[model samples]
Target: MKKIVLIIALLSPLFTYAQNKPNKKKGPTTYDLLIGTYTSGTSKGIAVYRFYAENGRLAYLSQIDGVTNPSYLTLSSNNKFIYAVNETPKGEVSSFSFEPKTGKISFINKQSSEGDDPCYVGVDKAQKNVFVANYSSGTVAVLPVNKDGSLSKAIQTLHDDGAHGPNKDRQEGPHAHMSILSPDEKYLLYNDLGTDKVNVLRYRASNEKPLEPASTPFVSVKPGDGPRHLEFSADKKHAYLITEMGSNVLVFDYDNGKLKQKQTITLLADNFKGQTAGAALHLSPDGRFLYASNRLETNEIIVYAVNQETGELTFVQRQPSMGKNPRDFAIDPTGKFMIVANQNSDTIYVLRIDNATGKLSPTGSRLEIGNPVCLKFAPAQ
Candidate 1:
C-alpha cells in the first residue's frame, strides 16, 4: 500500500502538467467592417467604414469618401486594395488603395465598365483582372487591375442576349445582375435577371480577356425565375441560387465546372401573400447556414440550414430586418453580426446572430446614410 501511494503521488504532477498545457484552442480576434453604398443623388460620394469588434461590441473606427454609387465591393487577397462598382447611368468601376487602419480610401483610378448601369464587380483569384456586370445594359466587362491598385481600360465586354418574363416592366431587357469568379479563377459566372439565366465565361487572367461564347455556356433558371445572386459551397461541388422574381431558392449539383439544377425551395409561407423580390444570397463562412434577403412587403432575411452531405437547404427561420428595403446585407468577417443596408429607409440595420440556431435579433444601432444600398465588412485588426 505504501509503494502504490508513492507511485500515485509521483505521477499526479505529470498528469496535471499534461492536462494544463493550454489545450491549443484558438479564440476570436478583432474584425474590421467595410461598408458599401448607394449615395443619395445629392452626394456624389460612396464610402467605406471600419468597425472594430471586440468584447462583444463594435465601434465605428473611421470612414472614407469620394466614390460614386459603390453598390458592391470586393477586397484583394493581400488586403491592400478594394474594387467597387459605380452603379450609375454612366456605369464605371473604381479602384482604391485601402488603408485598413484608418478606413481611408485613396482613389487609384476609374475605368468605364464598357456597359451601362454596372452593378456588381469581382476580382479574379490571381488579382490581375476584374469583372463587372452591367445590369441595364445586360453585359459583362473585364478589366485589368494594375499593380498600383489602379484600373486599366476595360479589355472585353460581352452583351447577354435574351429576355423572358410576364412582367414587361422588369423583363424588357437583359439585366446582368452579378458576377462571380470560380474557385479556380478560370471562369466568371454572370447571372442575368432579365433572361433568367446564368452565363459562364472562360476567364483568362493573364490576357485580361473572357473567352467568347464564353465557352462554358449558360445555365437556365426556371421560366421567370430571375436568378439574382448565387453562392457555391466550400468544396465547390454545389451552389445555391436565389430567384429574384420568383422568390425561390434552388440548389445545384456543381461538377466538372458546370452547374446542374437539383432542388428548388421557397422561403415564403404557402398562404402568405406579398409583392416582393429576393435580392442577395450568401453562404455562411462556416458553411452551416445560408441567408437570402427579401424586399418590398416584409423586408426581412430568410435563413436556411444547409445539409453538408447533400447540399439541400432546409427552412430555418425568418427574421425581420430592422430597416426597410434591405437592398443588400453582409455577414461581418467574424460571422457574429450582420449589417443590412436599407435603400428605401436610408438606414443601416445591424443584427446580432445566434450561432447555434442561426436566428437574428435587432441590435437597434442604426446608422443613417442617404440611400444606403449595400453593406460589406473588412478586417479590423
Candidate 2:
C-alpha cells in the first residue's frame, strides 16, 4: 500500500503539471479586415478577411452580400454594430450586427438616407445618432439609432444649395462629400465639395431633432478646392481638410464650431505636377504623422510630419501606392502596418510604417479584390 501511494502521489503532480502547462505554440495574432467596395462591378458586397499581422498576409474569410454599393463603412462605439452607405441614386444606410468571435456580420435593417447617392456614413460618439452625406443631392441626413442597433427614419435633412464652385463640371451643384463629428461630439461638420464650404451643425444627442445649424453656419474654402474629407487633430484645436479637386491640404484653427484657415499646402512635389486628386486623409494613431492619398495620375501617399504643438504639417516623403487610383487606406491598430485599397488596380497593398520617420515601406504583400474603395480593421477575437 505504501509503494502504491508513493507512485500515485508522484504521478498526481506530473498529471497536474501536464494539465496546467502553458501553451508555448501560441496562435498567430490576427485582425479582421472589412473592405467596402463599389458593387457596380464584380464585388457583390462587403468583403471580410483575416489579416495575419505577424506575416503581413491576408486570408479571405467571408463576405456580406445583398447590400449594394457599400462604398464606405463605420462601426459602432461598442464594436457591436456596423454601418454602411448604399451609394445608390436612391440612397440608404444599412446596419449589421457584428460577431467578433466568428468575424461574421448579420444584416440588421436599413433606413432611407433622405438624399441621393449617399457617400459617407458616421456614428456619433454617443452612438445615439447616425449621419450620412449624400453626394448627388447635396444633403446631410441625421437619423436616430435605436438601442438595438437599428436606425430610425431621418429626423432632419440639411441641404446646401447655392453658388457653385469654379469647377463647372464637377461642382455644378451642391455635392456633400463627407459628414464628420467634432472630437467632442458637440458639433457635426459636413464637407460640401460642390459649394466649397464646410457646414457646421450643432448636435445634441439627447434631442428629438439632434442637428441644427451652428451660429456660423458654414465656412468657405478656396473656390475650386472642393473639400472632400476632414480630420481633426488630437487636441481638437486643429482641423485638416483635404480638397479633392485641388489636391491640397488646408489647415484650420478650430474653436467652438468655427474653423479659421491657418495654412494651405499642396500634396504633390513642386516641380513634378501631374494630374492628382486627393482621395483620403488620415492621421496616425499617435498624432505624429498625417497621410493623404492622391489618385488619378500620382497614385501615391503623401506623408507629412505633424507639429505636435502647432498642428502644422511639414512635408515628409511620398510613396507609390503600388496600385492605381488608391481611394482609401487604413492604419492598423498597432500602428505598424497600413493597407491601401487601390480602386482601379483592383489590389490591396500592405506596407510597413516606420514609427520614427513616418516613412512607408512596402511589405510585398498584396490582395486582389474588385473595386475596393475603403479599408477598415477590427481587432481579432
TM-score for every candidate vs. truth?
Answer: 0.90, 0.91
Q: What would the per-residue lDDT of candidate 1 be over residues 275-304, giving only the tens digit for each residue?
A: 888888877778889999998897889999
Segments of candidate 1 deviating more than 4 angstroms = 1-28, 41-44, 52-56, 162-166, 214-216
**Please, what are the lDDT tens digits per residue for candidate 2 over residues 83-102?**
99999999999999987657
| Per-prediction CA RMSD (Å) | 2.8, 6.1
User: Candidate 2: lDDT of 57?
Assistant: 83
Worst 10 residues of 2 by lDDT: 22-31
Best by lDDT: 2
